[model samples]
Target: MARPDKVAAVDEIAEKFRGSSASVVTEYRGLTMSQLTTLRRSLGEGASYRIAKNTLVKRAAENAGLDGLEELLVGPTAITFITGEPVDAAKALRDFAKANQALVIKGGFMDGRTLTVAEVNQLADLESREVLLSKLAGAMKGTMAKAAGLFAAPASQVARLAQALADKRAEEGGAAPAGADADATDATEAPASADASEAPASAES
Candidate 1:
């Protein structure tokens, strides 16, 4: 590449680094085109692979405020994958490495933290972002449902109590209650009047 071209290439890589969540340095020394293609496909969506000159990548990393990444830009290096979620790219690369012997994962960074090979593997084992969101949504829905049930319990009890008192009054053959029974009957009857106001009105044609 020409001097100006090299500079532009370096600048372009730097721009990518600035925006990337995490970048994995891998040795694609012996990977065939088919193998690379398979690797790309296997990484799921939003993962990418590209060959980059180490020196340029190093400069980009430095410009992007990413230090300690130069160590990973070693010999026979060709691919730099980026993602919006730092762990996603790491996870994909780790899984790919597990299946392909030729593809070696040197190391990577996650949100400014340098990740070891093992760390990357652990990240891959984690549930995807979508799955985590769904779990949170389900939990929230369950909590809301429980709250609704709790809120309606007292109203339900009151309705049943009103029914029971009416049954008791009928069973007594319309005989008025005396003493404490009178007070209970009055209390029960008071709620029945209020119940008419509280009940939902049926639509009339």
Candidate 2:
């Protein structure tokens, strides 16, 4: 490559390193052009797998202030730059490697930390961002529903108690006037009987 082209290539790789959320270095030794295309398609739009010269990639990594990738950049290096969810990208790479044994997962860097092959596999095993978010949303909705029920419970109980009191009052009101009239009639008869008894006493005197 020409000097300017080499410089541009290094700059592009460095930009990828800086812009990506995570990056996985791999050795695509025996993969054919068709297989590489299939691998790219499998990775989806969230990641870009590029075959670059190791020297340029190393220079780019160093330029981007990313360390610990120099040792991993040996022998037909292809780097997968993940701009979206790392887990999804890791999963794609892992599954593709499983199918094509020629694709070797060297190592990766994510969140300012270097990842071994085991770590990358573990990352692939994790749930995707969307799935995790959906689960969290479901949990939040359930919690909100419970809170709403709790808040409405006291009001529901109060309404029931009020209705019971109203029913009791209605039942007692129907009989209250009849009982009052009966007591009044008994009071009047007692006064009249006392007067009659006093009249007999006066006659005897």
Give the top-scoring candidate (TM-score). Answer: 2
What is the lDDT of every predicted structure here? 0.78, 0.96
| Clashes by residue pair, model 2 | none
TM-score of 1: 0.73
lDDT of 1 by residue, 67-183 (tens): 888778888776555765655666767767777888998887767877777777777788878889999999999999999999899989999999999899797865654566889
Supply the global lDDT for candidate 2. Answer: 0.96
Give the total clashing residue pairs for model 1. 1
- TM-score for candidate 2, residues paired by index: 0.85
lDDT of 2 by residue, 157-194 (tens): 99999999999999999989999999999999999999
Model 2 spans > 4 angstroms off: 141-155, 194-205
